[model samples]
Target: MSKTGPDFYDDEAVFATYQRHRQRVDTANDTLEKPVILELVDPVANKRILDLGCGRAMIGKEFLQQGAASYTGVEGSKRMVEAAIQTLTGTSGHVIQQTIEAWVYPPEAFDLVLSRLALHYVADLVPVFTHIFQTLAAGGQFVFSVEHPVITSCDRGWSAETRRQDWVVDDYFSTGVRVTYWMGDIVQKYHRTVEDYFYLLQTIGFQLEHLREARPQRHHFQDLQTYERRKRIPLFLILAARKAI
Candidate 1:
């Protein structure tokens, strides 16, 4: 059973689950996020960067490697933040253990803001995105990734016939709907539809530059089944948006 809530991440077992699949997850994320970052950012000797919901600091580490002037990470999970600190010990960035919604920052503090596989956890996204817009300098980019809403709405469990299907797992159109995961007890994830995402961005004065669906890599497919399934259905979404000047 999957664990739920903030506690879902704090538990040792949850951390171990991430640890066991760390290599695969990291490789996949790098393949998707790094290229986007490269395309959006030119190398600069000194540029202030902020990584929100920066679990484990993998993306922040990449920014440092690319010669960011300074980097700061906001992470909600204590365990993940500690791991990130340990991972980035010798690097030039600092990790703050706080939720993005509650973390305070001066306006226009960063030249670039980045996040990965986060944002959906927030039940209310308007304030979060608004804060991000306020935090970025003019022309600064906010690059982040979230679970594709289509994939989230689909039932994830394997079936004897199709393995996966577009059966609705939860309400896609409802506002403030709580999705209980792993037997409806372990974890709860909230979601807004694709339309909701775009609408929110429009309201916040962010111009959407790029959007892509990240399907599972071919290496993950053993038989033709999983490969075909992923090809037909994506598992994740990657997006990059910039604050209008």
Candidate 2:
């Protein structure tokens, strides 16, 4: 099971129990992911976009509404592709049901590549980054978000049951597969440190442009206690990198 990934998430139960919330960007994602990635990439008019692990392809709709030239979403689940298709009908976008790990990248084909809260699930990231590098046009930007290292570093609970509010972190620097109990069931996510990600990107011929560990606004959050706890630790890491022109 160590070599396996979370059993190809095609079922509805898995979708509900998986990472995404309410078929859209949830609090943590909207807070830490959207703002930072948008600020860096700015997917407006005349840009061709590629989305990896594109769940529901909701961003594709926003891209089209913003007058983007085109959008292609690669998703692993057929139902996710269906939802994306339903959401993206009559728009300049198409969702392909395929895993990003196996999908071939079209060389220098896209102006912008985006992945949101998806990279951690894959066991290896080096080849994927290489593909992203090759698929982007000169000066093209790749913006993505992944689960925070502290969050993925350990599975130990920070629950009230343990009488602890502080997160438990272990084996932080060791890179390997981690099984996470999220939403409801067990899911697999590979753990990678900040230095590991930075080194991979730099070695893959990507220039770092922006990096942010963001948090939600207090006013926007209703649960003060949960918000306070989250404020102390980041949930997501957003990054933007460019292929040299």
Candidate 3:
């Protein structure tokens, strides 16, 4: 079986480190991924929403506050699920502690399904995506972001200490489980190309609507240096697709 479920985040040290990063300003998730995802998932009012791998579910709270009809988050980590519950406290949000691969999709259920910087953890996308397709009502949108293929390709033969001026994108065509070192732990992430993601969704009966390689906008960033560094390479790939009516 392809390993799924809060593999690394279960580690207290790793989880703590990740939470710290999330709290920091100008991080990629705050500066690049969120802005792109939020724009792509606009007009959230009155939409039933599902969030996958919803770490802490801070974004889920935001969606609820934006007037989503209902919000459900599926998360794997026990710690994360607890934090997510706290985040959604006093809101119309429900959280399920399950991995994306294992969760059963309720057919034609949600108006919008969004995932942020997740999905790369799945060893396979076909089943997970098929579930998403089956769960979305006709005309419902699925918007998600993943670490860019160029960056995921660097799981091997790339050094983090390498100068920002250059990024070594090796094994672009070799797509599969990538062993990566992060926050003093070894983590496994699946790597897929831009074409891989597009074709997978297309094959699953989703009509592609929008695609973005997370580009930095001046207004979204407070520091000019962070903005310039983010511009060096696309750190995120966001896609929006709709189930045909």
Alpha-carbon RMSD of each model: 3.9, 2.8, 2.1
Worst 10 residues of 1 by lDDT: 176-185
| Candidate number with greatest TM-score | 3
For each candidate, what TM-score against the reference? 0.82, 0.89, 0.95
Write model 3 residue lDDT over 1-245, tens digit each, in one string.
22334968888888898889788778888888988888898598999999999989898888889888999999988889999999999998989999998999999999999988779998889999999999999999999999999998975555544534667799899999887777667788889999999999999989999999988998888899999888889989999999999
Badly placed stretches (over 4 Å) of model 2 are: 1-8, 17-20, 23-26, 158-164, 219-226
Better of 2 and 3 by lDDT: 3
* Candidates by lDDT, descending order: 3, 2, 1
Question: Which residue pairs in candidate 3 have backbone atoms (N, alpha carbon, C) closer than 3 angstroms, thus clashing?
Answer: none
The candidate with the higher lDDT, 1 or 2, is 2
Off by over 4 Å in 3: 1-5, 156-165
Q: Which residue pairs clash within candidate 1?
A: 3-186, 4-186, 4-187, 47-69
> What lDDT score goes with residue 147 in model 2?
90
Candidate number of the best lDDT: 3
For model 1, residues 87-139, the per-residue Cα lDDT tens digits are 79999989998887889977998888887776767777889999999999998
Q: What are the per-residue Cα lDDT tens digits for candidate 2 across 122-174?
A: 88898999999999999999998999898899978654234346788899998
